[model samples]
Target: MDLLSRGSMVSRHGLVLLLLLLIGCVYADSDDQVFLEINDHKMTTLSNMSNGSGRNEQICTLCEDFASQTLSYLQDHETQTAVISGLHQVCSKLFSLKHQCLTMVDYYVPLFFANVALIQPEEFCQKVNLCEMMASLRLPNRDGPCTICHNLVVEFLTKLKDPDLQLEIIEVLLKACGKVEDHVQECKKLVFHYGPLVMFELEKFLETTDICAAIHVCKASQGAAVAATLLADA
Candidate 1:
């Protein structure tokens, strides 16, 4: 081919290469912008959380109060206390934080409701009052019978062996649950469905007859706050 013709062909290839490079640069710029936007959004969310946005001041104070109350209950009912004690103690410590206090409360508040949602005074009349005065709460903006209440009572009656200890537990649960009204229905359903399973495990634990079974029971129940606690952690 002639030198001029060869030169023209090389120029055409060079123009195509330049266009490809420009397209790649445009994509890279678009990707960088997206990364910046995402990073900025994440930072804004973290900032809002730090500022306690959309959080109630009352709930913040209650978290600390709850931790204190649980510690007190555990201290008072030393003999009957179990894993629920440890969960409160940790939550108590976490509650001391000025930060994320409401979120922690939000986690625990529902479990308390579920813990005592089933007890009925009539049902437990022959037995201990698992359904004590505190247990019979008419949650605000709530109506209808609990879907899980009856089965929960049955489980409490048959599956749980230590009636006295269980009484103290239900009382403690009632106290916490009584204080918080948020997510009452949802938490009750979660516990009502899952509480029997947990109790089944606890019932098996109780049957072990190991001297340290109480300690293990306490460990297992850590989430009653354990149920709420584990579910919250999840």
Candidate 2:
């Protein structure tokens, strides 16, 4: 080939290479922009979720209170006739969501009484999904139900020296277990079985003991942190 043809061929190849480089740069910039946008969206979503935690907590408190009140009423009026009358009285006193509360009581009271021996007020709230709603709103890095149960039990053991606070701690731990999802039944069972013992034989259980493992929420072979992460993911 002549010099002119050879030079023309070289120029064509260089132009093609330049076009390819330009396209590559454009795609690189686009990818970076997309990545930034996705990260920004995640941050915003997390912030919104964090802010909503307060509202969730309030709802959870209401559910717990309702459960406690209902249980008290039932215990006070154990007979079928009294329970029927008390249900309406309880619903009337709710002040908020009166109609809905009545409906819920009508629907859940039978189921609750049927399993009354195995379930507590907190567990009842969970079975009805009121407290479970709060559990669903748990934020990133927040403790899972099992971890919360473990920590509360440990706290109860540590504070066993306070006679006045023993029952209060047990109640709080039981309520916390009600909000648990993955191991709700197990948590409640453990709390009910061991909670009374905590008050009676304080010397038998130690704060250092692995209560989570005792309840089987955490396995002996697996780390507590690992079990917690698995539960949280579940």
Candidate 3:
């Protein structure tokens, strides 16, 4: 080819390459900038959601009080001193209050579980009343049924990372459920439902060298069985 023609063709090729590079850079910058904006918007939405969230503080207060009162009733009243005494009236009232208080706890307990470590031990003690009361009442009323009232135990296991607590809770629950023939059916379903999830966590917990951590995996496995038994026996 002639020198002039060759020079013209080279100039055109160089210009095309430069144009393509500029177009590619523009698209890359646009994508990066758009992704940053999306992330920033998500952060802003999350912040607003957090700020606006509030729980039923009134319900929480009542639950705490009723649980405390019921515990005090057990401590002060002791074994039935007399069948005809007005102490029976107080006991009835206290039991009634405990049941009512658990309803409130059911609504607010998830919130408490979210930040469980920050909550005072006394608060946890009060909350334990709700679990114990629900487990004890065996109420016929379907208003707020006892479906996995031990959810707090599972959550505690997840956060506390203690196997002994997991096993203790499992044993206590097994003892509670073993008494009731009616619980067999429900326990069977529960076993299938929560078994795999807790097992997965237990497997993870087993990897740790800490004895305390090791205990959790062992207990979690038991706890899952206890949960299964609840539905199984029903």
| TM-scores of all predicted structures | 0.23, 0.26, 0.20
State how far residue 159 of model 3 sits from its true place (Å).
4.8
> Candidate 2 local accuracy as lDDT?
0.43
lDDT of 3: 0.33
What RMSD, rounded to one decimal, does every model reach?
28.9, 31.2, 31.9
User: What is the C-alpha lDDT profile of model 1 across 1-234, one tens digit per residue?
Assistant: 011112232232222222222222222223465434433443343343233333344333322333333334333333223323333333344323312323434444334333334433232231221222113322222321221222222233342455544444333333233222453343333234334344444443323322111222234333133233222332
List runs of model 3 lying over 4 Å from the truth: 1-160, 183-196, 199-234
RMSD of 2: 31.2
Candidate 1 worst ten-residue window by lDDT: 1-10
What order do you get sorting by TM-score, best first? Answer: 2, 1, 3
TM match of model 2 to true structure: 0.26
Candidate 3 residue-wise lDDT at 101: 27
Model 1 ranges with Cα > 4 A deviation: 1-73, 76-179, 209-234
Ranking by lDDT: 2, 3, 1
Q: Candidate 1 clashing pairs?
A: 83-218, 83-222, 222-226, 223-226, 223-227
- The sequence of per-residue lDDT tens digits that candidate 3 reaches over residues 184-230 is 33333333433344434443332221222122312445545544544
For model 2, how does the per-residue alpha-carbon lDDT over 1-234 read when each residue is reduced to its tens digit? 011112232232222222222222222223465434433443343343333333355546645654564455434434434444545554465455355545544654554454444446566554444453344443333655455544445433444556545555455555444333344454455456556553444323333244455434445555365444443454
Q: Which candidate leads in lDDT?
A: 2
Steric collisions counted per model: 5, 0, 17
Error of 2 at 124 (Å): 2.5
Report the Cα lDDT for residue 102, model 1.
39
